[model samples]
Target: MNFIPQFTQRSAGTEAVVSLPHGGRRPGRELLVRALIGLAILLVITLLVWFDRDAYSDSGGDGLTFVDALYYATVTASTTGYGDITPVTPGARLINALVITPMRIAFLVLLVGTTLEVLSNEVRRVLIDRRWRKRMRNHVVIVGYGVKGRSAVNTLHQQGHDLNRMVVIDNRPASVDEANLTGVAAIHGDATRREVLRRAEISKAREVIVTLDRDDSAILVTLTVRQLNPSAHIVVGGREGENVSLLRQSGADAVVTSSDAVGRLLGLSAVSPNIGAAIEDILSSGVGLEVAERQVTANEVGNSPADIRGERVVAVVRNKTMRRFYDQSVDTLQTGDNVVVIRKSEARAEKERSERD
Candidate 1:
């Protein structure tokens, strides 16, 4: 099985936290249903008294009407009796003692349901926050769930990374809602702020990605994340080529200039159709060809990159160092070398099994 980290995010002061929708009615709906049931109880009592009008007396020394019965039922069910109406016969007294009293208790319980639900929401929030924080060690936090952020996560997920270990941080409510809809936790806050990063547990994160719209904001967030997690692998998205060095200096491990990358693709498409098509195929994930990294197995040791049967190996990583496939230093694949290869997405399972082989 592939073991990948999970995801989580928290906003300032634990205010904007929501997980995937679980089974339950909405609080408003629940309250409405309970109110209807309480009303039903009150109506039943009112009808019983109204049908036997001679059994009840009014303070005005007049025959009891349906309105008087309703008033009596309302006051009695609410436990706010005004002593203006009283049961005059054994039948009315008996029904009040046996039926109305128990339903009065039910009515009160339904009213209390509203208060209980409010308290339950607060308690549930606390428990969920605690559980999430407890399981958040060494996870990935992707700040700013824009196009870049979505692409990065899509690549990771297609390559068998765990979506549960992915947390999205965005200042937009819509972005946060989208993350939750996709089953990824989200934090709604400014990524450049210290408290926001702390809320995401940045210090414990293994990887952080900054994909903010503004290059300046991305740089600031990268610096803040780096200061918080000196050992984390932070990848940033840059809008302009000029800010590449500034982003790197801000502590981004790698920076992708989106505009330049797109511009090059556009140029390639105009100049050479075949080259552009091949590049697009490699970039697209979860279908057709995909780029992935896997561990070298016992079956493939001491073999050159060209010897791999299923996938084409492009680079080899050994001892924390990467060597190009053409580099003679990595001609023989070592037992623990990690190879970056291009393989069929549909055959991903076969490729993963190759690691064990």
Candidate 2:
């Protein structure tokens, strides 16, 4: 049985705030349905009284008519009780007190409750956002919720990173909502906007990932983030290879060119399926095979790459510089060196086993 390595990080307890767009309001289906049902009930009760015209008296000296019934129903259901229409018989009065009153209350609730709930929820959301902002620090800011951005987030989660310490900012409301549904903080706004970036606490962010669909937008967002936090790690995804250098120049510490990467993957798959599969496995976290960086073990110290047992050492990172296994300088592992290894991910093994059973 393989064991998955897990890391524990402290929670910052900061939540994401959402900025809703202002537009024309449309009634929700629930509200519309309830309103129709309430109206139907009121009409039914009014019609019942109107059919038994002798049961009602009118101060206006008009014998009960369909118009009178409709007017009475409207006034009664609204609790206005214009006093122009009165139930004269005991049957009518009993029905009014027992049936009409409750229905009237229901009608009012159906008509007005949705608005009150919306307002209450808005106030509560604002309060929660204020609290969230106060506690946010050293979080990861994702500038877009596009495909690349989402994949990056998924990998971070599988690597045991604290998602609560991450915030997603996107101009698309749908994307923001999707992030929120996954329990990550999301802000619906253009990431290139300084105010939006500031609201996301870029100054205190430890890292920022820019994955805007447009290379220009990603570059602008990266520049804004870099200006906000000179020390933060800024990684950007550019759609075109030519923009990769532009993105890096715009202050991105790393730039992944989408088209070039896809092309490379395709080429590798066509040339050697096994090698391509191995690369894919390593790129995908918590999968069949994975690449991970770990501190040099006590047993590994003073040992060559070929001497390490159980895992394959692809490279060694010493003093923030990476050297491949083929490099003679990295032949002997030293203390403080990080080993980049390729091995079967225990999480994937367990998941496969579970699926099999």
lDDT of 1: 0.82
How would you encode candidate 2's per-residue C-alpha lDDT over 1-357 as one tens digit per residue? 111111111123433354322223323554577777987978887887788778899997869889889889988888888898899899988988898888888888877887796666657667656666778898888888878889988888877778778888987767875776566777877777787788788999998988888998888888888888999999888899988888889899898888999899989999999878978888877767888888998977999988888789999999999999899999888999999988779797798799999
RMSD of each predicted structure: 5.1, 7.1
Model 2: worst 10 consecutive residues (lDDT sum): 1-10
lDDT: worst 10-residue window of model 1: 1-10
RMSD over all Cα atoms, model 2: 7.1
Work out candidate 1's RMSD over C-alphas: 5.1
Kindly report which residue stretches of model 2 are placed more than 4 angstroms away from their true locations once superposed.
1-16, 19-41, 107-116, 349-357
What is the lDDT, from 0 to 100, of the residue 173 in candidate 1? 70
Clashes of each: 5, 0
lDDT of each: 0.82, 0.79
Local accuracy of candidate 1 as per-residue lDDT tens digits, 283-313:
8765468787899989899889899998999
> Top model by TM-score, which number?
2
